[model samples]
Target: MPGQLQIAVLPSTNPRLGIVFALYPSTELSSPEVASMGMTLPSVPRTHELPPVPPDAPFIARERLLSLDVFRGLTVAGMLLVNNPGTWSHIFPPLEHAEWNGWTPTDLIFPFFLFIAGITTHLSLSSRRARGDSERAIRDQIIRRGALIFLFGFLVNGFPYFAWANVAGIPDPTFLQRVLDRLMHWRIMGVLQRIGIAYMVAALLTRKTTLRQQVVILASLLFGYWIVMTALPVPGEGTIGALLLDRAPRTMEAWVDRVVLDWTRFGMGNHIWVGGVTWDPEGILSTIPAIATAMLGNLAGRWIGQRRPLTERLSGLFAGGALAMMIGLMWNWVFPINKSLWTSSYVVFTAGLACISLATIMWIVDFQKVRGWTRPAVIYGVNPIVAFVGSGVMARCIYSIIKVPYDGKRVAIQSAIYQAGYASWLSPRLASLAFALSFVLLWYVILSLLHKRGIILKV
Candidate 1:
């Protein structure tokens, strides 16, 4: 890693600049160290306009739009794939969550999505600024995008608004109580909701403030989260981090979620959760630092859009990412990087990975011009929502209402499919992965049609 750090690093110019490309020595950068930095090498181009490639980026999808789309698509794909496994009974290590602390590939999905969001936001806003779009317009766009995303999340959660039946076939709760419970049990703060809020806040912050100011905001939010999680005494002193884990009263996020979230939906408090605070993973206060995740991404986006050489931009991103990650890791020794908490360390770790990943994509798509292998991913990348929605609809239909006919009993379609194809040929892990990919392809066909027809269902 030390040797890699010396592999022709470059400094980034100030915030408001343009893009460039430069050649440099190859280097190998990986993990805890990787977490600390903007990103590690493996180059990709930012624009379609660039020099011919001699040493292309390996495994990275080239094509600026495609890179972003794929990163986004991958995130969406990952969410669906992870959320929809053939059998939770036997999941691959990468698909599982960390026990108490530590991370796996699954943990990277959310932050990676957020990272791409930040990158896309920065790139889009910068271009608009260049095209004479007023600051007011850009701000308006951000707000609009944010609001729409928020609305969509709410709508999605609100769908199929009925729970499993009670005794005598009666519904467990009344509509009013259910609605109230949405806030009470509504599982307040979720994947899309977080994305919406984070995007809006981060966009405004980035657009309105200076880069230095943005950096300050990022640090403050992360530090603030750490302070609150640790310094605040548990209300009545049961357990420290526990209060922040579930629907506990002392936790600031739970209180806010109770007020702001759909009570009927997210309010159960985990079955045995006993945290003093009961923090919803996507609860209100937690979103503050989530904005920092996007900010780092925007900075990277701004840097990628800069006029410096491609190598230079990649170098700077890696350096800055490295520094942030290092700072986060050191902080983790004290605060710990808890994704559920969205702690400062988590931010640092995720943000560093984001930069490094983006740099790799830039190297491949933009620099190397080798996009052949990325076609399948690119297909999935084009329409993320289609993939998400299709998976959602299909899963519910097959796994629930549309049962498969089996030995005199109704069987889940998913189970039947797995038994017929996946089980028959591949190993469980391979079978599960294959199902996930096929699921992606099923949606890809629809998205490809939409893309061909220019019918994007934008938020």
Candidate 2:
């Protein structure tokens, strides 16, 4: 699940400063793996081709790509930076999400991770096939992993639900009612949830298909989504008016979210939180295009894993990325390139950017063999699930779970720390940036230690 970090404010004793600092985790760290919670295991070899092994044999490891790790690490670091601002309200323009349309550096993070997942999926599956695993065995592994990833997202979404009563300072509450409330309004789809869904679908689609077939599927998904979103008449709206799509609740995406994940069926209405009404950016309809995003990654993975020369691989990636960006921009004339919608244009544009970004990293890290500066990103990249999940949980605990008394009132520990430790010395935006940077640095230290200890937490 994309970790949703909510920021709350505390009343301060100082009369001059009305809102001293915002506290808590900011927003979703939606990724496949949660941090530090997975069991320690030996590092998997980068590449391997063992003799035919029994079906019951432990899954053979594939060659781990340093560029992929570094790319993933860079994405995770960006996730942390954008998510853990000192004060959510006072963030730099680049870090904040666009109001409704357009894109930001922050918007690229999720898709980049998804792209990496696609690449890794191809590499991993191919490695298993090389080791003589049957199609059934590989398919089972995909299903199991996908289900577990979805389950993890669900758990994170509902984390500490029971403890809400305590956090809210409710002395006593009807236990059953609390449980019912939590269950009734739980968010069904999120960052990790989307990843799991896209991963499963893309993996299955690419599992048996050739590159040409995969490309066809990708095109079909994007075009189909565009047509549905733009042409189909929304239930209540008179005609298929583009203007009607202005409000999120009026769009087809929100309608599907209502029908599929509607809380009213459970006697609640405000269960999900895209626009906090009826829409979710990571809702079902948007996931169609998201799957295309993953497929694009799969194509890239296939290209990278081919027996071609390094220059050829990089050239193909760069050319593909440029072409995708051009096509996306052309489509943006009609589609407007919105991230929340995960519009066809958005998918291609973001995926294009991801490709170029990854290619640049690969060129430097792999082609040039200049790897010294990649250590930080590699560390975060190697343990993304841990970094994302751990940071998210920690932020939630600091913001919501743990409380500290300040000026005769209990305040969130995050706010208190931010105000005293950061806001005291820095401006609000700088302080927020500092806090976020500190969070990233802290995780680097933790992940670096894990890397040193050979503790990889792969799902």
Candidate 3:
């Protein structure tokens, strides 16, 4: 707060006297107050002589970085595009996740989101602390926000609240049975759920710690995960974790998911990922590295928030990102850059890329003053939760919840529409890509309207 305040002096109308102006941040000084005092706010391009205001004015808010929002928007848009293909089987190579032990462009979307969340979490906490918010209040807020996001993700996983018995060629069941089925099969881990967990853990870890302390904790997490994942032998697998890296069922992360989430033994097991049933991409053990990923972003946020020149900050990002990438590549020989596992090497590599990507955006949008092409991404970025949750619900409705008459019997509305509108006119891969793009464009329009109305769906 002290660093943000600036003071200036100018000659008054009398010319013999000089008036001192204390430029409280625009957040602390309202426009009307600035006008009444005959001063220009920081955001305004004009200058004026003004009476000095008290330096201890209460903190109100801080300016957000446009580059951050644009980055987040692009990530959210990419998530929508990747998640809503016309047909999952027809996706391009870059759009689909790697089958195992490697990554693609699609894999980066989730980690980028987590990284952005870490940066925003830092900014938000700093603003609150500046406002004299108590530690108790901040912790409660973190817990509450993280819980709500997790619950929302859970609901999204079981959206429409109905069983697809009829769609799956089974006889329709009673409403009670449908409800029970949904609860039984509801996924326990997902993108937003992992995000909520990572956000909460990373925030609390960084809350009362110094930079050196945080870096130590971060290194411990990465190394601890590596030690357990590679050095330790997985229980019952009769082999070391390194030997089981290629087998999803045998990996320590997947084994934990099966044990803790298995409803048969633990009463929560039925909630495992529907994709694999036995393992999940966002499973429990893997979340450790995910937390490290968020912490990495938090560290980057601290660096960005320093009172340093823009060029210096940009240079640091480039150099640090390069260093991290090199480290990740070296470690990948042992751990492998596996997104599903959220491996340590994967965390370092992806976070490095995140840093460099963000720095590039900052240079283009923040330093270079280029503004015209940023509008669409900004709209999606500002209302990320809206785009994510809304698109998710809409996707579920079309893909599974609704049915339409097809060539012989009924089919999911999504399939019906895709076959008739897109696949009918283009190659399978092209149709899939086109459908995904349409989904992105549709959300852009929706988010654009929300932006115009000054609506941002925050969690």
* Model 1, global lDDT: 0.59
Per-residue lDDT of candidate 3, residues 1-459 (tens digit): 321222222223332112111111111233222222222112222243333432332121222346765787788888999999999999999999999888899999998988877776665566556546689977876776677677778888888776766423347678777777777778878888888889889989999999999999999999999988888889898888989888888898888898888787755327888878888989999999999988998888777766577778889989988999899999999899999999999999999999999999888876786857877776676556677789999998899878999989899999998999999999999999998999899888887666544343334
lDDT, model 3, position 185: 79
lDDT of 2 at 130: 56
lDDT of 2 by residue, 1-459 (tens): 112222223233321111111000111111111110111122334242223333332221222245766787788899999988888889999999888888889989888878877876775666556546689877876776677667767788877665364423346767766676677667878888888889888999999998889989999999999888888898887777366556778888888877888768666744676255678888889999998988888888787877677788899999999999999999998987888889999999989998999899889976887877876776676566677678888888887778999768888899899999999999999999999999999999997766665454445
TM-score of each candidate structure, all chains considered together = 0.75, 0.84, 0.86
Ranking by TM-score: 3, 2, 1
Residue ranges of candidate 1 with Cα displaced over 4 Å: 1-66, 164-188, 236-279, 424-427
Write down the lDDT that model 3 would get: 0.74
lDDT of each: 0.59, 0.71, 0.74
True lDDT of residue 333, candidate 1: 77
RMSD of each: 11.4, 10.4, 8.8
lDDT rank, highest first? Answer: 3, 2, 1
Which prediction has the highest lDDT against the true structure? 3
Please say which candidate is ahead in lDDT: 2 or 3.
3
